[model samples]
Target: MGGQDRESDAWVYVVNSGVLLDDAFASLTLKRKLERGRVSPENLPPSIVGRVAKADGPTVEAALEAAAAAAPVWGAYPLETRLDKVGELLCRRLTERAEEITRILVAEGHPVVLARWQVSGMLECFGPESLGFYRSQMHQEFRHGERRIQVRRCPDGVVCVNPPQNAPLSSALLGVTSIMAGNALVVRAPRSAPLGVMYVLHEVVRPVLEEVGAPPGTLNVVCGDPVPLLSAWVESPHVDDIMYFGSSENGVRFQERCLTAGKKPILELAGNDVVVVWKDADPELAAEALTESFYGSGQLCMIPNQVVVHPDIADALIASLVRQVGHIRPGRPEEEDVLLTPVLRNEKFFGCLRDALDKGAELACGGHAMQADESRDTAGIFLEPTVVVVRGLEGARDIDAVRHETFFPLLPLIVAERAPDEVLLERFVAYVNSNEYGLRNSVWATSSTVVDTFLSQVRSGGLLKINDSHIGFLPYLPTHGGTGLTGGVFGEANYPILRTSHLQGVSISPGSRPREAVFGAWNALLPTKVPTAFPTTFPTKRSQEF
Candidate 1:
């Protein structure tokens, strides 16, 4: 492999007619500059990059043609082969380039720690334990003597992936698992942050694909405006399914379009996740978990958007949270341990705060916007990790912060009204369950009964975190996806390998007679003789059951 700088390499990847197409399709010059080891406001790759992309919106049709030609061949390969190639070989390559990938991610405005966290999450998803679990779920069989019944997940031919701009690299990593599900994939990398993702694909993943003897056009990577690229996928007969990530409002509308075009839509949309703190909860642990709301300046869809605290512990919990918020100051992305990114919607942050304050709410700490170096300023790019205390649940959802998914570092803590344990617990769980959007919900509780109650009743989101890190990734747990607006009609805990595939049942029966098999369920009730021994010929009319 040539040692070309990935940030400046040909960003678009296309192959057609069994031949590679590496020519420049779109010259995306999303250039930035590093000032004193810190990423500047420009974001994305550094100044060395000339053009950012190679593929144009219209050129995506060639990707579809290439993917279609490769789907059957790629899907027919054994699942184990696919897993070994991606889960092992590709995993190794990524590990070798972990430092590089993290640098690129950090340069693209992801904080250093968050960049590493993203890379680690991708690795864990491809780890043996997780891959093994996926293998187990991919197929299951039950045998009855020589006859067998099998339930299995099969790849849905060609799949298209549209990763979100906020987390392009990680989403691209997940999208590649379509190959593990035996699909040929076309990845439409987010134009806002395509370089790092395209770099990983070309440098790490494509090499592994070649090593595994995968056919040409098995995976296509392109970059352009999502509107046209998505339309291209929706209109194409060669495309089978689309795994899309975007805001819930736009995504649900796009889901309708995909359906109208007779294509399956797999959505990863916005999350209005909740965190509940009961009286029996640990304040320190709850504060730490709640800090996830400020990660990536709270633009991340999976992080907690609002909090619900029992009135018994609201004061103490709010104090602890305020102290913790003091430590979450804004800084440049490449700075050590910085979590905040430059938020574009400072007005929305203030708007939510103002609405909350107008409607009987109080700001505990960190409400105003700040600059990259953490100074208070009106026109600063970063919104301080702000926490608003909303007293009581009555009419709380009417507030925009409580009802909607605010893509800022503003957290609304609903202080439950004073009540008995039974009433408070019941209402709190009901509130979380009734949220319009659900990706994740976390609870910090020490009492066994309280924990069990919340777990049993709050059943809307995809994943439930009990006294654990809400944003942390676990080996087998789904790291992305949820129900309601977070995922369209077919949304649940997303394992991309399974999401891009469809379930099918296979049955095998040998040497079975048609008429005998028909009445096999009632064989014991039949007179010990054969049907031929039924006196003379059977009645002219057959039984209604038959």
Candidate 2:
């Protein structure tokens, strides 16, 4: 809150140094471009998203210089010391500032409950259990007979993190795990929702960094368009890695740039996740799982964007889903009872709906655009929870409603009614595997054989769930990142501590003698007579069987 004026909704830069800039050259004024509700688009409110100091050439140069100067020293610290100091500090600060952070998120149009959940999730991610889990990956060794081999994890110089606008704080925290492995960081808070993330970094993390005597550039925060800084990073030789979260197209192109510049890129791209319901799955549970499509108004990457159900159970599942979704009503973000809020992409959403309807897809429920309830101060931007039914993947493959990622409260159901059970299963598996996005996928099935087959056959999603909640966070598990359109060539379950670090193998012996020399006799074979030159003579007798 350094440069923030509540009356004008103006906020100052929240940098690692905790100093506010007064000069125009050092600051960038960011106005609220998109807001909740569909009222008065022309006369936008005077809310300031943020007024941050730009990370220009000179500023970024100094930051990279400091980080480069601090890398060796920070990396040399004992792993346990870094873990104890940084992990405990993060947990304490997040808990102490939970209410303040949650309020900021809610004010930014996040449902009150969802905001609380996000805050709590961030806290939990930095908790003791998560720390311990990551610590376990630092340095591991195993003894074999008379020798011991060790696998040591080391930081990859400097990492630049670019968090997405949708979940800035959570994304930044994910990158913070790099510190546990002793890597220096430069984090970019999302411009649209920078306050919560920026506040946490400045108010909570910065003080602790000073207390622990962390190097000046061990952590840096910037708020502005990432394009220029990304270009700078691509050209900078000091930067070693990048943690990027963005659209599939942009992420793929950025990854290419990183590769060209000889830098490592960890990507978390767009997701069009799916939930497959087999004929034998529990109808009630399947319906409940499908409800996740509307959670956070279907804005999350992990939520199921489409449902593929066996025709035998399609009617029952659809009925259950319709009933469950009917209970969800869009309410004001600040209200405690609110379950959903308005998203700003009105044109894209309406276009997708129109395309779906025109393509012969039937709207099962909640088809019309939501009308604002002026009495309740609700903006008409909120989309009614909608369910569209398609015959199968082919029916919607060419339609935007299914092909592209629709980050709104729209769920499309694909009924695979093609043929015999085996053919249906095979086609369904093929469809899921062929999907470009690979964030997460869920399957509802009672048969162990069916579950096993799906898991073995489908090589699409990063995290596959069997009869469990699709979006639930598992701290110990690698729940972030995906494959294909989700994450590019180097895609894997994202564990920042591991992804930001590299593994080195260490071998130990009791003696100083070279292994080759010590085992020379055992490893070598000699003939009766040594032939210095190539010999033409050879024996052609049958050899004895061993």
Candidate 3:
């Protein structure tokens, strides 16, 4: 999904008490602009942007209350039963409604192909087989000679889901797995990209939720200013967990609130992912991986924000990247041929590019802003796919381009001038780790030793892709979350089904040995033992006797 212009509408959806309510007391206006640079009014669609009604505090509270009331019943249900019945049905609905959802995404400025891909990904994640790993992770049985212990995980009582504005459908789709783990959820539709997410939840998933005999309040969707809704969830005593996806600035603050309220927060915050290219790495492959920086206009959390390359291959890698970038076409997101979307922040893009260049970095290619024309004419939304090269670390680290994350299509490449040595490797690794945001990082190297060192030494992102694309979402593996600023306090790969729950240890004592042991320990602690029917053999030898 992408940003769009906002227009007012009368539609309001609040899923509460197992029903979809249309009580929109307050409203939020969002925009969806198709043509950039003040497109001729005649060419634009009549209603590209629209507004969504907001849920009041009491309404949100009611939703949470209902969810709390239903949590026990849902949480007690069998995991496999929920996955097979609810998950499978939701997956089918997503597939059936894929085209409709894709159309909505396209209308919101997502590319036709990319929109389809997004829906496809959502389907994959919703598929029954996708959550099979959590079955074993959530439940385990063990036994010894005399003791039988069953170590299993149970869902957090109630989860309040606040997915990111970008890719809301896929992100909120994670709540399904939470349900599969037997937890009730209240998912907030993305304020910016609610159309697709709303369609999936209301049209596809809601029906199955009701049909499967999922208790009322098991699932709720509220649309409004996130501040109040989140506060309500935090204040609610019954809410057990909050899954948040957004910037570190807001996320850190929310995490604090969650901690203060004694609620678990599963955060998927910002990422300034880094990529390292060793001297022996394939320039073409490195370029391919780094090119992902342009994906989603570089707005993605997993996009490669910075590249650290050996000087020997830095020039070659830059050349390959420039060549690859030349093929990128910026146009309407609904077009099949367009690879780059209009950048939302033109000033920030140019400002970052200017700062990098002023700091002794060279613009390898496509750094300047492009003028709007008939074919490509989106103002403030279209930036040339840019690649900036920093020959050394002197002025690079202080520059905003390298130091901070700009959600624009800009890739900053830093050159390690020194040869590969323990000292240089250590310095480079430190540099990569210095990035405050850690979501995912990668190393492009042919040498097993270099790869191993990079893996073992670089302690940055939650995920380390040896040679894979930095932005691809591998559903089977953990894709969201990271360390440092990416996830607060508790940072790791976010597996919602597992992370939204806690482990519970159950021990079954087959004999009365435990009772006897407790009695003996109590008797030893007490000077006078009450009359209890328990046989205790005195030790044959004591220290004094010996």
Measured against the true structure, the TM-scores of the candidates, in listed sequence, are: 0.88, 0.83, 0.84
* Clashing residue pairs in candidate 1 (N, C-alpha, C atoms within 3 angstroms): 25-54, 26-53, 26-54, 28-51, 28-52, 28-53
Per residue, candidate 1 scores C-alpha lDDT tens digits across 1-546 of 111222322343211100111111221221212212233334432233323554654467777888888888888888778876568887788899999998887756678889998998988888878888888888888985466889999999998999988999899888888889988888877756777888898788888888888888888887777787888899899999999899888999999999999898999999999999988888888998898899989988999899999888888889899898877866766677788887765777888889989988888888887776788889777788998889889899989999999988989999998989998888988899899988999998899999989877877988999999998998988889899999988889889898888899987988665665565545646646445222333555664335
Candidate 2, residues 141-240, lDDT tens digits: the string is: 8985456878889999888899887788888988888877888888876756677777777788778767787777777776656788788777998899
**Candidate 1 deviant stretches above 4 angstroms:** 1-46, 521-546
The best candidate by lDDT is 1
Q: Give candidate 2 misplaced runs (Cα > 4 Å).
A: 1-55, 144-147, 372-379, 515-546
lDDT of each: 0.80, 0.75, 0.74
After the best TM-score superposition of candidate 2, give how far the Cα of residue 162 lies from its true spot, in angstroms.
0.9
Q: Please provide, for model 3 over 333-374, each residue's C-alpha lDDT reduced to its tens digit, 9 standing for 90 to 100.
A: 656776666554588787778888888888888766564232
Pairs of colliding residues, candidate 2: none
